[model samples]
Target: GHHNVQRLSTVYTSMGMSNADRGAPLWKEKRDTWASVCDDCHSPRFARENLQAMDEACKDAGMKYTETFKVAENLMLHGMGEPMPKDLAPDWSGQHIWS
Candidate 1:
């Protein structure tokens, strides 16, 4: 059984945690904290390898999201999305209908 929930940096990021600083991102500090927790039950080398794998996975996902946002923005700019919320009528539930 593997347990590493305490080191889920992505969850912290999603919750709007500040990893930014005046000079550079605080990624190293966060990584150190994660490694410290992970090292409690695992060897330092094992913890480091797992953390590096997680970092690469997060980097790849961020790149994919950047590309996806660009495509969505381009489509919206070209008027590909028809009947936007502003043009929709409010339904009985007081919410704008997508139809």
Candidate 2:
């Protein structure tokens, strides 16, 4: 599932291993390993296509999340939502968020 993709994206990006990191080879290696596993049960082309579809789905999910976060941010900014608890606020300077 793409459930962990968002979190992994952040982690890998921070570690300079994300797919978006221009010179990184780790991301491609990991992707190839994943595709090989999928190929065990499906044709290589089918596995590749499915992986591409999943990537697209994750991209869509990320866009939706950004839109949702914008709404939440607006609500907070306009005083329409409850204030975030101090302990749960995102620490942007520290690049972390607490529950």
Best model number under lDDT: 2
Q: Give the whole-model CA lDDT for all candidates, comma-separated.
A: 0.55, 0.56
Top TM-score hit: 2
Per-residue lDDT of candidate 1, residues 1-99 (tens digit): 245665563533531212223123545666666677767678989978986775566556556656776787788889995544754532343321211
The residue pairs found clashing in candidate 2 are none
Query: In model 2, where do residues sit more than 4 Å from their true spots?
Result: 1-26, 87-99
TM-score of 2: 0.56
What candidate 1 gets wrong by more than 4 Å, as runs, is 1-25, 83-99
Name the lDDT of candidate 2: 0.56
Q: In model 2, what lDDT does residue 17 have?
A: 15
Which clashing pairs does model 1 show? Answer: none
